[model samples]
Target: MGLLSQVLLLPFAPVRGSAWVIRQVMREAERIYYDPATIRAELASLEEQLESGEISEEEFDRREDELLERLEAAAGVQQGGGGFG
Candidate 1:
């Protein structure tokens, strides 16, 4: 940016910095959320819960579907598609 523009926007620097930090955090969060290994671990945990009778079969099915969707979304992202949709 030009010196004049930088000076003019100096007052908003903190806000801009905060926004950038938030964006970084969101990107990291999404990375972790859609990670295949994480999803697989969760799926295993869900199975253990079912086996231990901690969750009903219906609950297991619902959660399994959700995890499978995450896996699909992760795969799509890896293939150059973006976002959950």
Candidate 2:
């Protein structure tokens, strides 16, 4: 952009910067959320909770299904098959 354009847009610089930061944070969050290792760790924790009687069998089954779906979605994304449809 020319100097005049930059000068005109300078007033919005803070807004632009804030938007960029938000995008970066969202990307990082998605990366962690879809990580296989993270998913596995969560699964282990869920199992522990069930074993300790912190959660009922029904609850465990529901949560396990959700985690399995996430794992499957992650795998699909890794294989370039796209995310949950």
Each model's lDDT comes to: 0.93, 0.92
The regions of model 2 sitting more than 4 angstroms off are: 81-85
Candidate 2, residues 1-85, lDDT tens digits: the string is: 9999999999999999999999888888888998899999999999999999999999999999999998988998989965432
Residue 84, candidate 1: Cα error in Å is 8.6
Stretch of 10 with least lDDT, candidate 2:
76-85
Question: After best superposition, candidate 2 residue 26: deviation in angstroms?
Answer: 0.2
- Give the per-residue lDDT digits (tens) of candidate 1, residues 1-85: 9999999999999999999999888988998999999999999999999999999999999999999999998998989967532
- The per-prediction tally of clashing pairs is 0, 0
Collision pairs in model 1: none
Model 2: how far residue 28 lies from native, Å: 0.4
Q: Residue 1 deviation, candidate 2, in Å?
A: 0.7
> Candidate 1: where is the Cα deviation over 4 Å?
81-85
Which candidate number has the best TM-score?
Answer: 2
Each candidate: RMSD to true structure?
2.2, 2.5
Task: Supply the global lDDT for candidate 2.
Answer: 0.92
